[model samples]
Target: MSTDSFDPVLLEILGNKFASVTEEMCLTLQRTGRTLYVKETADFACALAGRDGRFFAYPRSIGVSGFVGLECLPAIEAAVAACGALEPGDVILTNDPYRSTGLATHLPDLHMIEPYFDGGEIVAYGWCFVHCSDVGGRVASSISPVNTEIFQEGLRIPPVKLMRRGEMSPEVKLFLDANSRTPEANMGDIRAMLASLATGRRRVAQMLSQHGAAELGAAQGALMDYAAGKAEAVLRTVPEGSYRFADYLDDDAASRLPVRLAVTVTIGGGKVHLDFTGSDPQVATAMNIPSCGRPHAWLTLRMLALVQTLDRSAPLNAGLLRPLSIYTPPGSLVNPEEPAATGVRHAAAIRVNDILNGAFGLALPSVLPAAASGTVIPIVMSEPLASGGRMVQVIEPLIGGTGARQGHDGVDGRDSGISNLANNPVETVEAELGVEVLRYGLRPDSGGAGQWRGGCGMELSFRILSPGSHVLGRGMERLLFRPWGQAGGQPGLPGSLVVNEGQPRERRLGKIDVLEVEAGDIVTFRTPGAGGWGNPLDREAEAVLVDVEAGFVTPDHAKAAYGVALIDGRIDAETTARLRAAQTGSEGTVFGPERDAWDSIFAPEAMDRLNAALLALPLSRRQARRREIFETVLADLPSAFPKSPANAAQAEAAQRRLETCLAETS
Candidate 1:
């Protein structure tokens, strides 16, 4: 192999080879791993990193796909600083978000790093992570969105060695065993992670033996450089301008106030800048993102997606982030200080994804798609057993659909825009938990209507078989503000949780902390749908009839949204022609009636100004000031102000109150 200016053919070959090594390592872990998160959800990933501690070869087919851009340098440095130089046989382990500088985003994700030795020197590093079972804390599964600090989330393991000099550290094992509710399961996953690292080490040694050490080093650098060039080339295609957008999470689980994430993307000089200065200050909840600023993976995922979509051949590595720069204000949601609970960081990340997509859509309207369902909730059930302890397992990791792009419909019941996680099989979920799976199917007529329709959402219903069973659903979102559409498209419907549906005792829940139910109780979860693209009137009449016949679009929606009449699973062309001729299309993008109502009271420009002002104040006073402002407006409105639409008179009164507060504050 050529060391200097290696052949392009060889570079591609080597890139594939290295990436395959990571995949093989992942396969090894999945085969040996002992957890549903690994065998079912595929929550683990393995990668080969350069000496600089940045990934050069990341598995594209398996594991958490968004973490490819994360840098391992901080975690490696922290480990070395704490435990001297890493030897060939030693492996460092950590799940501390702050200590590893965001290498491990949350406590449940155990990260392991192993050094590959060749000729008495470190050639590359092997990195992998798994979202293991319960880490003992305030609740089972060790995650609660209402947890105020990291301490309440779970045990935070800093950068320490689980293995030293090829031997498992007994002290680390003792601590791990003591601090977890499922010690055997957690250790089983840990051992699987170690096996993955060993696989990577052996693979790296073989590659080094075949290609020579210097050639391997040169290949790593070349792969990154190649990816960097590709990323820069794609970024240069985005129109040179600054576009600003802001989005909101329904609320921090502990409070009614919505959490805001604002961004401004400036694309120029063949590079992009993401300025998150106007985002809300860190919340006192687990939703806070511990990005540690510095263009972290969670913060830069959209940019990476944009580039990859434009150029699919671009290598998946940290180098794709070379042309991007980021600014996250200190103490902000995106860059929270240490000890902030980050158990539910993904909830914020989906909003950040929307904000970035909205902002970039302004600059590259044709290239970007509309907002997706913008929600991912993992529904878990823990039931008391006949013998002892609780039998806990995730029923399903529920998610909604992807947004529609120009000239194409959004994908239904699948959204890989953020994390590409597979849904758990009903058979597997039923075998593990004390529940009877009743309904697991798509929610018909849920996708927003457009020329190219948005994707439909999912619905899951189950019946409890055991008494004293508890259901936990975390990271639930899109319950309030609907997923907005683009270019005259309509927003999708909001999600909901219902208990004992079709019964008198049924209750509609927007968000859940924890709900306890006895035997015979039934629970249902319906996720929101993605946003559409273009005017619904522009959709072909035949297409509307097909959708109606297929049960995807109702006959009523066909006539109302698409201006096409359908009768008895057939198109009524004459009535459709009359309806189309009489109907008037909406102008530009539509964010549904609910968002419009909220925007009337708290307009975008006014909210931007308010957020800037709140950010300028002291961190301790920001939340208080924001609450005061919102509460004053909400004082006169209904209890479910935005979720349940207000009357015209009530909206006007709320608008006046909001304006008065903004005037005084700004």
Candidate 2:
């Protein structure tokens, strides 16, 4: 495509070589890293970037897969402008979302960049990131959904030299050590990142020595061009049209008001545009996504997923995003301004994924699947030890099932659509924390009933063995809207959190910040199930009988949902025939009763007009005015919103108030 194009065979060889180097770099980091997140959850990544800061080679099977589109140039340029240019053994470090132009999404995600020098000039760059255990702030993990500002989240390290001439910069080291609660763990992770960078440097040097610097440079550009061409070819398959879809998060964690995320995808001529203009304003809490109003990695993850789905062999690099464009409103939740806390940005990103998935489905229905469980809550246990030090360990990284598609049933008890984090073993979690696992399995009948059943959600129930233990369930969602089904399919069950089931003092909570429990206290977390596809009546009677026997679906549920009559462990053909004939046809995409009730009041078209009007006002007035309108409507209903449905009278009053506000707005 360019003057530097090499032979097709050689280009393929070099592309594999560069990708292998980055994968090896990641393995080295994981082998050397000391934290549970690195060793088990794999919350880390490594990449080889071009001089322009776009990643040309990224590891495919390791670490966070969504970061391939993240730009390293802004952080590199900031470090260079602040402190001179390219030299051997000079590395840059930063975790400030604003300072790095959204390179480091949050303070907990520490990013490092190293310049790969050959002769007297820089050839390529080495980049990596790790989610450290803690950076001292208002919370133990430096993350809480209620945090209102970045300063409250954790230490913000601007792009500065962490290493100079192979020596650790004492001044930067001191600040880092002083600002972290787990200083030793943070330092160990940082050293592991440095080790990963060194591995990249060595591998890059060998390539330069074998192929010469000129060919290596040409290969970098050529590989990215190849990936871009592949991505464009995939986009061309979508029917040329504009599709709009909207989804909602239960709330902004700190408030009872439901948060909305809407997207309009326009596809034509081998290109796609994602417009997120009607998303809710940046919240006062930490759920804001720091995209810097640009096509950040978080905003373009689904487009990358689309390309990969079309052609698995398509190169996993920044070039995959070449055919995609994005428009995230400046102060919207997707692209918040500086000073906003982003510790829980993943919460917003999940809803963004759903909206984009829905919009694309309108254009290429067969190419995409239904919605996944769309929630990830790493259930963390923090217990006070006898020695007075606190012990923090994840009990389990709980997830729900995948959405059912045209011909395939959704996956049960596991969803890797967003982040593919591994769950902690029962023995490992028990040994680390003062807890005992009671039950960990898929929830029965949690999957939405359809011709092809949607994936089932998971259940994690445990008992705390020690007093003074606080459990944190961050990034929990889908409790309100419920993952929706499509094409006459039914929605799955909503998620719930329960304490001391069957006891006299039973409690059910929603979106907890932290819940302290005494010894012998039991806690159960049940994630929401994914949406199903096709109609339940169309499902085979034998499949329904099998699900009933396996306890995945109860006998009564099978009869009601699938109209399959089962008697004495056998399908009753006569009764089944009568039941199927009387069953009603499904209408609309099922979002469950909760979403239907809520949307009845805050309708999509009205909310779109309201959000646009709110964004038009000054930034300082947006949140206040928006909150006032929601509070007015919620004032007439029960404290628990969609969870506790409003009576006919309450619903009518709330709808009237909301309509008045929308009418007065624009």
Candidate 3:
């Protein structure tokens, strides 16, 4: 049977069945999983993949939402080539990003694939991955942004059978147990994954019994084709032209210099091509994205978001990526070479999503929203136990608000731009770990000011109750450049970390490696707010008053940002009218004061030329040479150069010095 002969109604039914199977698998994994990251934060995902290795059915409301496009074929092929053809009840496991052809993105994300057989022939594969607590690395949780190579990140499990012929492989289990800091917890999650795969296998067999093998195979292709058509229709709505945009990570964890990500999206004839040509070279830190030059999930997540946003009923599968093509420059941040650490690749992916969002927004201004709070920090705590061991668990998955759109305000204290992870409840955190939750709530006046106000950021303050405890806040970003606003809207506030709120012993820090703390030390994490849409003066005074009442925007902020005066909890229309008349509004994307100052010295054109020259050199020399040029140019400026804008004479000298450096490189 071919897709042409398959009935539409049957295809829809099969699509629902396939989706439900994956969701059931997810539920099983979550219900039986051990770690806080798995059970509470839901950093795991389950999907059904076709024989070609691409996912045909993915869960909608569970697990990580951005990995629908991941390919499982490479790992499948690698396992088959190494250990011969797969038999019944064989499960292939791997966590090596490079070895698995980008299937397993990082060390902690343990990916497994189990072949489902019908009449002694393989029909579909069940796939699932969990972000394990530890895989044995230099740091406590096996992920540190400062790690320069993949070997230091964690244990690299190749594509081998963790379970063969319905029996667990003791050799593989032994190696896994020896390599992880949380061996018992890892095994518990592994068992949960096995249960998920078994659940998927049973569901596939039930579907086969109902629809027969031939019709089931045909429905897989037919459903994908339907989704592809819907995605193409959405792409056609976008204007036929090239839209270019770029954004930055605050800095590589090893250095203070920022990392750049550039993208040029071309949409024409119901197809989109993303060219990541001007992105910076792969960094020496763990912040590199391991895309392997394919249209990886990390590189093209925004396109998935766009199609889903336009066509709500489109099926969740690899077909959504059919109309998209990507070109990530070799050795660039998006396509790092082998052995480059990818422990925190999601940090770079968050910025990649921003650039893609910005480029697409240029084409569909009314459809796409302003920038989101571009950060996701998984604040983890490692407390000492009485048995001379350490207890490691995630405290909270911190994130800010989503960007405001043309007609709708952004969602406050919740941004799913990257991973849609749920925060650990305050009571759960206190119960699981040795900490007192001081405050967990939204920050007032954190969102950008506009007609449709941006979402406010979150604040988490806690005091350590255990002596000699350590805190790990990985993926911290948006400290320098704010989340940019659109259509003359103001930029959002940047993120900050404070050791203590109002004490002389307070010590403010940027992105940390591994922070050591003692009992009574209070730690606070404030995430960046999202960018707003349209001019603030155009926002209704009543809307500002409502925001003030809800504690999202303070009374003084309402007057300052939106030009609305609140008197006795009521909007003063007369005062608001005067303030609006006096206030001036700017047009186009507003990148706030910090970006404005940085752009004055290191302009886009200059950076492009510099990167082009640097990319021409050997990979080993790119990072060092690039660092030298920046250091020489910034020698005469203040220590905090970009944070504090340079003087007129200083800016001129820096620009001239940059020109000379580029000329010499040429």
Candidate 4:
């Protein structure tokens, strides 16, 4: 092997070594973490940043891939400014989105940065973050959609030094302990974060020892270039042009009103640009994405996995973003300004992924897949069984279907568009809390009707064996906009929740808060289904008959949705012929008109521009700006907020807000 180009085998070897280092760091944190989200679900990320503050190696399939572009430079700089000197035992803590320039979007997510030294000189930093239990302040859980100001949410730690030259800071510890609902759990998570930093520091130190400081630094640069090359190659494969896609949030959690996301993806040669020009402005709610107009956690996701997973050896760095650009106007949902409450940025990110998928599908028609179940639902239950004794039970984070890619039908009842977390076992929930698991199975025939039918969602039911319990479920997406299908495939069913003794009083609950339940209260949760892949009528006769026999489609729905008549588990010849004849003229996706209306106004150009406008306004005015934008579009429509099953009164009220905002913006 020549030194001029270096051996390809050696490059592969060093790449895998760095990859293992990050993976091991994750394992260490997971082993020590106390929270179920960390220990069980794995909603965390770990990475190694170069001296310049950009990550060189990020885990591809583990943790949240969107956080790969986070810069530790800001937090490091803040620590140096606040604490005069640094030592080996020192670690910095921060979750102030504005201070970190959007790196730590929410309060519950604690971010820590540690500097690693080589020959007495600081060479690089190791960074990690985990979603902890609580941080005290306003709400009982510390995070709610209603929290507009940072002071109301929880403790906002600037880059205060958590560890000073390797010793724990008592002052910082005191503040943390005083401000959290579960101080012990928070502290355990903190220790986990510290452990993560130490792991990264050790790994970096090891690489430095073996390769020498200069060679390690050189490797970082080389790896970044390599990622850029691989990413560009993927870009070139996407036929040079533009593709657009849009999705929505059910509501801001404060009202019945929905939020929209529209994206326009432009690809030329090897570079891609994501323009979120027409999305709603940042709202008062916590769902804003604090991007700072660069490739933020929310924006970098599509490219991160697309490049790295396509080539596992691609450098785990922002260099993948080197050949890509994001155009999110400041103050929009994707790029909110300072003091904008961003506790739920991932809520917006799920929509962003859908948008990217839609756009990419247009360019790479054969390569891309249809829409998925498109939501992450965590069935949270808090029970105080015996008089005043409290226990929290997370049944499981219920997810829906994965999209059907070319040459394959979509997978049933599983998705990872956001953080690909695992579902909690029924046994685990029952073992820990005051509840008995009733049902943990798939919802039969809940998927949309199509030639290449979408995947079905899930149904989870449980009985509160003890009294005085509080039940909460959140992170639910695709409840408003049914996950759309491509190339004439039909959309899927929306989700719902019911509470009762399996009777008519089993209410279709809206997105909920803590609900008090007594002994014998039976609760059932039905997740949404995935989108279909092709024209339903074009579906095979045998497939339709199978759907009927399997209880996936009713005899009536088989005739309507698939345009087939299945009598005695066999398709009627005349009906099949008519269905085929009717397919000659139909084109475009088959999502309902309600979804179409939502998608139109919240287009990519509109969203990017709206967010940019929001960024200019003070943080206090973000909600007002967003509400106004949506209201303006709905003012002229007959059924305002089309996604909702609206009546005249609701439409009038929606129009009032829209008309008022439109007039003001004008």
Candidate 5:
């Protein structure tokens, strides 16, 4: 290891300093960034990459929904090719996910790469990215599930020199200014990213002064190797075997059909191979992954993480990926082809997590936790008030319970498969908009029944105190298939939202737009519950009693979900014993964890193949491409197919019209 070639102690200190420098850089960006997703939501990331483009050190947790996959090498190389040479003061910007690989998924995700210089030579580069508010497109928010092509999604900027020498480029500036719906917000985010780059430059210089440039370079490579070693050790712990998992995309938004992803994970002798051979082809929609057949690290970080979690000693680094191999056939969802709208890749990724869980469960059933609530629907509802025109607002970001582990019941009302973002406070929601939050708490009967009952879901209801308003609900999934349970557990409830004028016959709206309504319209949203662990009757009476007092479970649900009867606030010990001993009926059969189901489907190779097939379809036939693929898969699942064929056929026809309209402009 180059780390050993140098002074180990010095390299360790330099490594610590490198991490500190990048962290401080992120802190600075958050303080200065303009958008709410930045300043409020904290969706951003900053890191110091070695001159080689690989991150020597990256944040463990911070910023943006999913950016651990982003890299600066390609963008930097592109800039050098364009400008002939990159000076000390130059910085590059690119949001083209296809060009940057895992770097930037969509246009709003602005990435900046700056070269760090030392003694007239380049040492490293600092990088940062944020999902800006807009980049000029068909919608107010630059991202939309309806976008069939990248062009409709937003302006695509390949890796380009945004700065030259010491000044911002005039052409870059003019182009950016013209292409954004929210130009001011985009510029604010860019400035924040640029500031982070400057921070990387400064801290890198400090590390060089202490450890010397050569040692710093050596440490970067060594650290990566060390991480790989740790990951391998972790892989060795899992019982060597091949595991299969599968998951689904609720829909491509343009079609009612659900997309399927299947993966088979082969892990043995410290190696992991992800195969996506039978997975469906790519879609015409933007909800695709742009991996280009290459096994991008971001695509498989969770698998690595699951291994690391099982083996706590495993180090985080690119080396961890060495033992991991992926097979993503072109024209699939996990690896999309040219111009397949990929505005929302995370939607597909969420399912990928499930597939890995299933495969891991097959290999190490006792070690891993059960499936989570299985979906994250941050439902944003907007409306207009009496004195002012209506605007959009997030009523609440709905989240489900966490999956139950072997020894513990799943956590209620908290899970972060995507971004472990904190839910907005109900008080904050009420204060910012004309709404009164009525119910914001756990869903009592929603968790799947099991030995250890599944965690309860949540229900949030509010009244629009003002008049006309609009609602935009993104990231909504698992509304049909309830969150599954594990062992002998039950499934959680699906979520729903309805608007009414104080009557039972209210209205349920799908992906909404501007709406007119009076002051008394009430909206309620319910999130799913987590799966359970073990058998319901086997659960200890004390645990059942505790739940009764917690209000998360009631006496009726206790008996129904767990077969534990309550007597005077205490479990009827004698009756419980009798009931427990008599446990029977189809009600007792556990649904198992959803992680078991989703994990079964979205294995690494499965995603690779799925994405590759999606990418193989030429840009022109993307909509029809996505529909046929998802429709075929959904046809098999009677209980699971979200898109009714009749409607999907209609939407597929409509998507072509929309794609044609977009093509004429593109």
Candidate 6:
């Protein structure tokens, strides 16, 4: 049966039914889940895949949001090739990124697929994944950004049957139990996933009974085709041209050298192709994205967000990716080799979203917003238990705000560009871990200044209640460079990490590996604000007063950044007018002072030429060569370098040295 055989009304109804089944599965998983990551953070997802192994239906409300486009075919095929054909009661489990061809991007994300059989023939598949608390690796949570290779990140679980013939496989269970520090919690979450799959199985069986196998199949195809058409329509709205943008990870977790991610997005004939040709080579740290040279979810989530933002009625499925194509260089940061670590891939993925947003904004300035906060740090704390083991739980999945658009201000203290994870409540966090929540709110003046102001960043401060505790902050970023602004707007402030703020022995830190803390130590994390949309001087004085009164923008900041002066509680009209008249408006994109300083020395064209030359060398030698050139150039400048701008002569000398080094290397 073809999609043409199904009426539009029937297709819509079937689409709703399929989506409801996935939501039900997600609700079931969340209700039965044991780990804090699942129950509170909602770091899990459920989906229904057709026989083609592409998701036809995925949960919208509950669980992680950006994984709708993940493919299950590779894992399914691997299982079949290894352990024979799948039976009705069999469930395949895997967390090997390469072995499953990017199905499980990292080790902690345990992915499972179960076939839904209809009358002895496979009709659909049930898929779900949970971020296990521990999978036995170098650290307490099995995810350290400094892990140099996949082997140090965690245990690799290739596609194998976790359950067979309606019975749990003892061999698989034994291996899983032995590897993790939190075996009981992992087992509980696994059981919850099994229950979720069962829910999907039953729901699909009901749909099959209602519409029969052939009609159900036809409806599935029809729904996806409808979504694909909608996606193409959205793509066609973008002008046919190549828009290039690049962003950077503050540094590889193990070093001070920045990691760059560049993309050239070409849109034509209702299709978009992303060429990641100028991105840096994969680093020795765990921040590498494991795309397997495919348009993986990490690399294409911005496309998904763009379609949904324009057409909310489009169904969430693989069809939304039908118009998208991607080309990631073999050993680049976006598509790393097999042994490259991926424990903290989300750090790099967040920057990918920024570059994609930047490129698309150039194509359609009014439709897309400026850069978002571009960071999501899952702050996990591990406290020692009396049983000679550590109790690991995520204190919070902290994130900043969205970017401002043409006619609106950005949302404050919340960003869903990547994972839309809900923050764990203070009470729940305190109950599970040894920490006391102190101050949790928005940071005033953190957002960029513009006609439409960017969203404010977040602040989280908590006091440790247990000594000898270890704090692990994965996905920490946006420290060195601020989120860029569009049009004539100003860039947002950079992020900061402080321990025991305002007290003796206070210390400021960059990204952390595994920080040890005492009982009375207080930890504070202030995330970066999003970028603004228009010229700050063009903003209304009344709007600045409103922000000042609401504490979103401080009085001094309003005077300095927005050229709006306030006296007592009211705006001083004369002073504000005088201040506004003295400032000149900026044009185009504003990448803040630090990036401006860095770029003055290492220009984009120069870096592009250097990267092209570096890519020609062997992968083993690329990183060292790139580092040597950068270090030699940075040697003559101040230790702070970009954060502290060099004199004209110093900068010119550094540029000459960079040129000479590039020529010699070439």
TM-score for all models, in order of appearance: 0.96, 0.96, 0.98, 0.87, 0.84, 0.98
User: Would you list the clashing residue pairs of candidate 1?
Assistant: 488-588
Report the lDDT tens digits of candidate 6 across residue range 603-661: 88888888888888899998899889999998889889689999999999999999998
Estimate candidate 3's alpha-carbon lDDT, on a 0 to 1 scale: 0.90
Better of 2 and 5 by TM-score: 2
| Per-residue lDDT over 303-386 for candidate 3, one digit per residue giving the tens place of the 0 to 100 score | 988999999999888888898888988999999998899988998999999999999999999989999999999998988889
Best by lDDT: 3
Q: Candidate 6, after superposition: displacement of residue 343 in Å?
A: 0.7
lDDT of 1 by residue, 478-552 (tens): 888889888888888889999999999898887786788889999999999898888888999988787777777
504-602 in candidate 5: lDDT tens per residue?
858875443334556777777777787776666677778878887888777887876667888788768777777767766333224433333433333
Model 3 RMSD in angstroms? 1.2
Q: Tell me how far the alpha carbon of residue 573 in candidate 4 is from the true structure, in angstroms, after superposition.
A: 6.1
lDDT of 4 by residue, 9-36 (tens): 6666667777787888888888998777
Cα RMSD (angstroms) for every candidate in the order listed: 1.9, 2.0, 1.2, 4.0, 6.6, 1.3
Instruction: State residue 656's C-alpha deviation in candidate 5, in Å.
Output: 30
Q: In model 6, which runs have C-alpha deviations exceeding 4 angstroms?
A: 68-82
Task: Give the Å error, residue 426, model 3.
Answer: 1.4
